[model samples]
Target: MTGAWWAAAPAMLVSAAILLVPGLIATAPLRLAWVARIALSSAVSIACIGIAGVAFSLFGVFFAAWQVVLVALVLGVVAWLIRGWVPDAPRERVRWWWLASAWVLSALLIAVVAFWGVASPEQFSQTYDNVFHLGAISHILAGGDASSLTLRTLIEPQRAWAPYPSAWHSLVALNVQLCGVSVPVAVNATWIAVCATVWLPGVAWLAQLIARPFESGRVALIALPLGTAFGAMPYALLSWGTLYPTFLATALVPAAIAIPVAVWPPRFRVRVGRAVLAGAAGLAAVLAAIVFAQPRVLATWAVMMAPFVLYFAWRAYRPAWRAGGRHRRRAVTALVAAVGALVVAAGVGFAYVVFRLGLFERPLDDRLGGPQAKASQSVAAGISQVLGQAWPAGSTGTISFPSIPLALFVIVGIVAVWRGRRLRWALVSYLALAILFVIAAGADDVLTKLLTALWYKDRYRLSSALPVFGVAFAALGILVSARWLGHRAVRRRTGAVAFAWGTALVSALTLVVSGGSSAIAVVFALPAASAADEVVSVRQIQFLQDVGRIVPADERLLGDPWDGSAMSLLFGDREPVFPHVNGQWDPHRLLLAQRLGEIETVPEVCQALDALRVRYVVYNPHEFGGGDPIGNQFFAIHDAVGAGLFEPLLTDGESTLYRIDQCGRLPAR
Candidate 1:
């Protein structure tokens, strides 16, 4: 594992370059403040990756490392050519040391937590969603295509092409190709890099924007350390669904929202025409990145920006209402028409997403009613969970304690910002998300589905987004409290040294009560041995790697995906008949899954295996989630060896590899 950690160094460097360099170069023409440029770089880089991937795929070119570099250079050159066209926004001249110190501290804290959580570079979350994410990266490498438009072909071959967010997959695949690391190593290292480089700085930038009228630099410093204090975000998402795409997109939300805030009327002081153009361009790039990374995040972005939109709309209405005489009726009518047009557009967009795009249509599962039942029992508990940043929804038992320190800070922050007109928007945005989370967590009805349909009404998804705004509020609270304490100390004739000690003591107490470090460890801990819930164990992976060496590349293996065999694509570099836990599998694959053991008894079984080119089988009976019901379809395959239809090729105590001799091998490619 130590070697694995050392191996991740180059992978992390490659990830940082892939995630940052292009954006930094391309956005140079915008002439933003250095902090603003750095904060938005990841979004720009992701946009470049996704666009380039689709372009390469369209042209039948390989999407490899050199291609990625070439795309970055091309974007940089285009941006440099337009340098004179886009007007420069005002740059705040904070001391370089202030940003440097804050970034270094934030990066260190985040890296420590991320590294400790991952435990090893090769380690990956064994959760359900990882099946698709890990396989998607491998699919990109295998097919030489990383386009979001065609990524779903891995699971939905019948469609041949479907729109699926693949920006995260593209970045990881590029890292693996450039660094020569395995998929798991690339995934873990890239996540760590994104958190430190993209997420922390992005949030700090948002805090600076929100507190711009006050000591903005000091607020950023206060916010940076607190970025890791929340449990719902980078940590919970990492463990729960292993939602790699959503995690990456959510990291950019703060920066994405900041673009509009910086450019909107009443707040922005720049010349309207040039500033609006620049802001709109930047916002478009970030939104493209968000859509590519995860389309679901667009809803989250819209929710967070709702208050700013209302504020802008209000500003537009004020002058119309105040106009004199004859112009008043015309101005008011124009304003009403504009507002109506916006509402109609929103309605159409919602319909397109729900019906035309066909996303977030999953119905609720009734089996897991305990959590929902408990949550619906008390709305107050749901509110407490959101404010405290306790995540994975319904984690209100003795094992999942609420963060009293965070809740108190958020309450204080709400009170502190209640009077400030601009900063109060943060409260409004936070409250909006908090309400959505409460609805998703505490209700499972028609209204809940209608409101949270974008997120499939999944409480975990809703809860994971709350911390995007919660952390800033908590940091603001701490900043105000510290300033007040220092003022009181000066008034009481206490020295600066006493104030410093008091702040240190209070910070330490807060950290302890928040349980930030301990909570991360608990959530990210991977199983050391094969468990019913865990997908694969250390020994199992070693065995798979060994089997990969002996197996021919041309032949595919048949196995129950729920038994962790789907991971063969990632760990063994060998294709599996089914690469995901669930999908709209074709009839032939379904027949093999249910009746592969009937090969001798049923002629169709042999024909199905032959048609699919599957000459080998992996029998790992330890199904994930303790014999998940999905694995029930493959019970016949599991009993094939005992039925004496499979020839033993290899074994590692519990898992075995068998050759299906009855199904004659297909001709070599």
Candidate 2:
């Protein structure tokens, strides 16, 4: 197989092993045709990664493509052994071409955005967070650890586990091992897969799950491509902060929603009672997926879906509690559904709380507080920013509001679904989530502090729910509006069906085309870091590589804890003296301000470096001394350079590497 195909082989395997078989078993009872089954399966499959990762950790094994094959085989056997998955009477048949067309269109749209922003040597996001993501991947590849639990030992305090979700990183590492792709290529592949394999298919599944007319699945499918167009999403995330983990986690949201929707719908009963059981399992899997990939995403989704979960519980049990003799089975079923869904939801939440999975023990940096911590945005300004009417230059990520037309559609859908059991869940949940977003952004210190207990006063992250639910609701709105137009015009106009379809198609297409065009233009239009910044970054990586040629891979480096310092750990395979990002491990920022700021004399500077075991000092005049002004305060080396206590090991114009072993100062030993 060609290398590209070789890289794709694992994706195909993952789809089959994790998605295809179980999806067949779970949805078979409903006799949901191909489109629904495939969409739901896509979600279940992503969740399976978390499960597989945990299993491997227990065995202390590295994740590879073949590991999925092993999991698939076991799941297949379990699937074979399970019974009672009786196929129901067939629903209205839909043509396969609609699904294929929608899939292709969604794939093309996702690809356009991904390829347009594709990072390369000359082209890359200039955001600050990219370093942590790129460096984490490199550390995994070089350090030879893929276990999500243990991998944090690379940069975190020794033996102290950091609960930063590593499922995304682990998957990238697996791709590298099995596909023999470079770390960058593997990173790109993970990004593409999250969008194409999970997000697109996931949206389709969610639409079909709740659509009133089953065939609205097709309309929902057609309408969902508009999802990529939202200003705060897929592209906005890339430009704003290069939030790789957030991107991965949010991409999995629709799939996460799909897991529960698959079961406990229509009404609750015992011959097929295991459906609720299956829902519980699927929910568990999705929770596992979220916890492993990005735990905060789980919290975010949980908060967003709080209302939906409550409504789900009420619907599942009310029928059973209210029904009589003839409705006894109905009552039993309803009770079962309610109990199962509620228990699972509560169980997941309980585990997260009890386990303290967020690693909150690590202190939050006082220097760089939460998004709104430094300076409060007035509630009015925050709302304006969230709606994309205006953006504060310093905000962490993109926040979007519905455009006028899109906003109109969303209101229509909300009203249309007011009485709909099938779709009503979306409305309540969205309102609940939106309220949280507003509260988080409120300027009142007391309110922000109260909400901080949820996500550290990070309002923008909560604002992500807008684009996610906004796209789906807007699509549904389009579907409802088209149907209304079709019904009203059937008697009043010629070719009413054709007219509704055409009007809907044109309107939906406009959103997709316009959104896609705007995203492409915006991303490509952003100035790449100045040619000077690029040269500085490229030379810094190259300089580190050259240093690696001479020093051991384990050499401890001391540099400013800014973007300038990324090269030492990312490219040079050396751990920096402090891996500081918003008070991650070290408290007080003492190491950053103290060790790097005041060193002057030979013995004094050497003693400080010895305490931290920092052997080399990197002075990138542009990145540290000159590039990012913050680097100077964090690691001020002007006095050391002036005093000649540091010996210049290498110099490239403005960048220099200094050996600390000068003035007869020997190694600590």
Candidate 3:
């Protein structure tokens, strides 16, 4: 199984190219700094994929890798044609080796952690959400339709298609088609690429932007290595929900927030006509890419950018009020009115997206009850977790200790940046995020619901967002402390040598303390155990592999999706009558799910079997989640076997493949 990882090389290369090359080409005319370009490429590429997928669906063309590449080329050509309209800004001078070393180190650290987490490339997460994500990729491969607007048809075939973010699935499917890797391998490859390439560099770029006037180079170097130390993000998210789309979107958040600052620098003196237009257009393209990746992240980006926006607005317009005159009062009034109008506009937009569009509208009285009904921490505990950089509660199934080194660094960082006029916004942004986390993790009142419902009021999702800013602060904190110590040393030579050693020691200590915790180790090790058969046992997988030889590819099988039978869609190239474990299934599917075992007695069961063209049943009674009521929907199939209605075609231990001979033959499609 480990040898199969070598096959993932093609998938990794293809995934990286699909994610980076198009954006690199399109943004060439902008002439951004090397780091900035690398940070924004994945966002631009995802945006292009979203646009291409929608256009293809509308034009009745199949979504394919070749067509996506063509779309990117066209956009690049357009960018080149308009190159002369945008003015060049002064570029930061930094040695290429410095940046390369930082990136390589970060990539290596992330790769080691990822490799340790999933011991085999073919293994997949066995969490509930993974079922939909994996099935969505298979659906795309089988049907060649990868549009976000129609991807939900995998589970909701009866309803009119509504948009669900498919950027993650679309990219993985393209890799499978172009690189010939299995779905699991493609998923693992894409995840590693997103982490090493997108998340690591993005946070470093953001650190550079935030730590302005404080030597950007050192901050970036420190941030690159420290970004992976936090277990709250990338790791907790990987284990908790295996929320793949959220993971991608959150990884891009740092870049999305940093691009505006990069494009329109504080001292930008370019002409206000064409240059501004070009910059705005480029920013729009990147923002579109983020929305396509995950719409909820737009809220995350807005929360982080609010402080910057207010600060910038004040800095831009305060001159008029300071030069007091007849216009001074009018200027002040205009500023107030403008601020009020913006507040109103934001309120209206949030309402429209939440209430009108019906997004993130999980009821407070859901099956698992609501956020209010769950076990929660005290407000003090939540704040302490944020300050200490501890893992969110319930993510690791055990109490997590705070990283003392990280907490101290964050404090020093907050104090260090508080005095800088522009750099202080990083602290403010983190404060806002921390408040939101506190509300979700500690309080469960109306305010919590109002502020956090966009994230489904889930603390793990909210906690996952903290490290986006926490990493930047901690990096700044470490560099600031190192410089302070270096300046105060007794001798110049001793100070220099001592500074380097001290910085390396502190970084290593922080990484060891944060990344090597028992809790985080468990999180990384969970995937390997999940793959060991928490859902589908090793015997069940072998049973499916053997049954694949006898089952016709064109025919479908009926079974409880929770019992791991739906996996045949990938392993056996045979679609299940129910593609997922949960959905508002169509009448025929629902009828079969409930009464397929009674095919010998119920006329509707036979009718459903005939209509759905299901001639086989794959029964594995070891249902996931230990036979929860959810799987009971398909319990009637157990009775069907007991009644001798199914003719056994094959058997492997407890798993069996049976032909539905009891149901009369129907005309072939």
Q: Give one digit per residue, the lDDT tens place, for model 2 in 1-669.
A: 123434454543443343345434433334444554565555545445555655676675655555555665555455444434422322424466655665656655554544443334123343456556665666666654555676565456545565456667766666666666556556655665666565666665665555536454454454446554444455545544556777767767876776566664534343445766655655665666666677777766775566676676666556656666657677676557756766786676655543553424443333225444443555666555544322221223333333455556656667767756556667777766666656666644554444444454555456555656666665666666666666653332223223323433443344334343243333323232222332135556677777666555545776655535554665576766644332334422344345444554324655555555665777655432125433445545545555566678887665667776542343544
List model 1 lDDT by residue over 1-669, tens digit each: 245586578888789888888888677666666667787888888888988888889988878766655676776776676555455544545577866776665665555644453567666766678888988998898878988888887777667677798899999999888888888888887987888777887887777676565455555656666676666666666655667898989998988988877776533445567667767777888898888899788778877776776666666677766876656776677567757756775686579656864545554433223332324535676776765545442122222446566667767767877866666666787887788778776776656656676776666677667767776677666666666766663432223223322432343344334453344344344566565667888777777787788778876778888887887877787888999878778878888878877787798987777777788888776877666553376677777866878888898887889888886776554
**What TM-score, computed on C-alpha atoms, does each candidate reach?**
0.88, 0.76, 0.88
Between the candidate structures 2 and 3, which one is better when assessed by TM-score?
Answer: 3
lDDT at position 178, candidate 2? 60
C-alpha local distance difference test of each model: 0.71, 0.54, 0.71
User: Which residue pairs clash within candidate 3?
Assistant: none
lDDT of 2 at 267: 43
Error of 2 at 110 (Å): 3.6
Q: How many collisions per candidate? A: 0, 5, 0
| Runs of candidate 3 exceeding 4 Å displacement | 1-10, 81-92, 115-117, 263-266, 273-275, 321-373, 393-395, 488-533, 627-631
- Of candidates 3 and 2, the better by lDDT: 3
lDDT of 3 at 660: 80
Query: Model 1, 517: alpha-carbon shift in Å?
Result: 6.1
